[model samples]
Target: MDTKFDLEKISQNIVYVKPVVTADLPTEVQDQVGDLDQIYAVHNASGEQLALVADRKLAFHLAREHKMEPVTLH
Candidate 1:
């Protein structure tokens, strides 16, 4: 079987990677991450949080896997 992906469409949007303080998160979320002091957050252009990952590298990887460009936010 064969499938097609529209390269242009996939590359149209950009995802931003930001560092989030674990303490600022809710207690449930903090508990989920255990001893992690920080986590990487991936957001869309409108600033909606998409994914919270363990590291910067994984955050970028998540965006690339979805075909969106990744940009760092300090």
Candidate 2:
């Protein structure tokens, strides 16, 4: 899939905001949002959405495939 967002820049900006594959998600999150397909947005403490992702796994896979290291939280 084609994406406008630059995955490399995104990874450098905030790894936590980075997307992850379904297999990468924690058990709790997986249970809550079963089969996560995409990440709409990520908000900061200021309540401002920083980034918008179309496909979660796709994005993560792209990043990994491209050798881009995204930040990971928890």
Candidate 3:
């Protein structure tokens, strides 16, 4: 008998999923960003297009700054 997989159960195994554009993105990045543009795209070493990255470094920096932490990568 064919059994259907439970979405909630399946979700627990997922580490990451495809990203999409959202209203939460910064205005500057949002202005330049496109409906189809992914803030971050996962790819193989060869650089093939894969998943979308909705988050950006600047946004992370802003968050870190708010917490008074160094956002710079060393």
Candidate 4:
């Protein structure tokens, strides 16, 4: 049996939006995050984290700016 991973497809055309709470992060991370209660996490189709944005709309806009489609996860 054999399996192949398509790198280009994995990296392209899609992004996932999910919410994360700053308070749930490690203390060092929380300190760096500075007062934001929550954020929208943007990840590539393959689930590699891309960015943490302040709002869901901003996350979507960021994906659009990079020419990738943004989709909400649950």
**Root-mean-square deviation per candidate:** 6.6, 11.3, 13.9, 6.0
- How would you encode candidate 1's per-residue C-alpha lDDT over 1-74 as one tens digit per residue? 57898866754588889999999999999999999999999999888999999999999888989988999999
Tens-digit per-residue lDDT, 1-74, candidate 4: 58898878755888999999988877987887788999889998778989988899999999999889899986
TM-score of 3: 0.24
Top TM-score: which candidate number? 1
The global Cα lDDT (0 to 1) of model 2 is: 0.50
Tens digit per residue, CA lDDT, model 2, 42-72 = 4343345454455555545554564554444
21 Cα displacement, candidate 3 (Å): 3.2
lDDT of 3 by residue, 1-70 (tens): 8988797654333332224444555677677666734565333323343333456554344434444222
**Model 2 per-residue lDDT at 44:** 43
Clashing pairs in 3: 40-53
* Clash count (model 1, backbone only): 0
lDDT, each prediction? 0.91, 0.50, 0.44, 0.87
**On a 0 to 100 scale, what is the lDDT of residue 63 in model 2?**
46
CA error at residue 42 for candidate 3, angstroms: 19
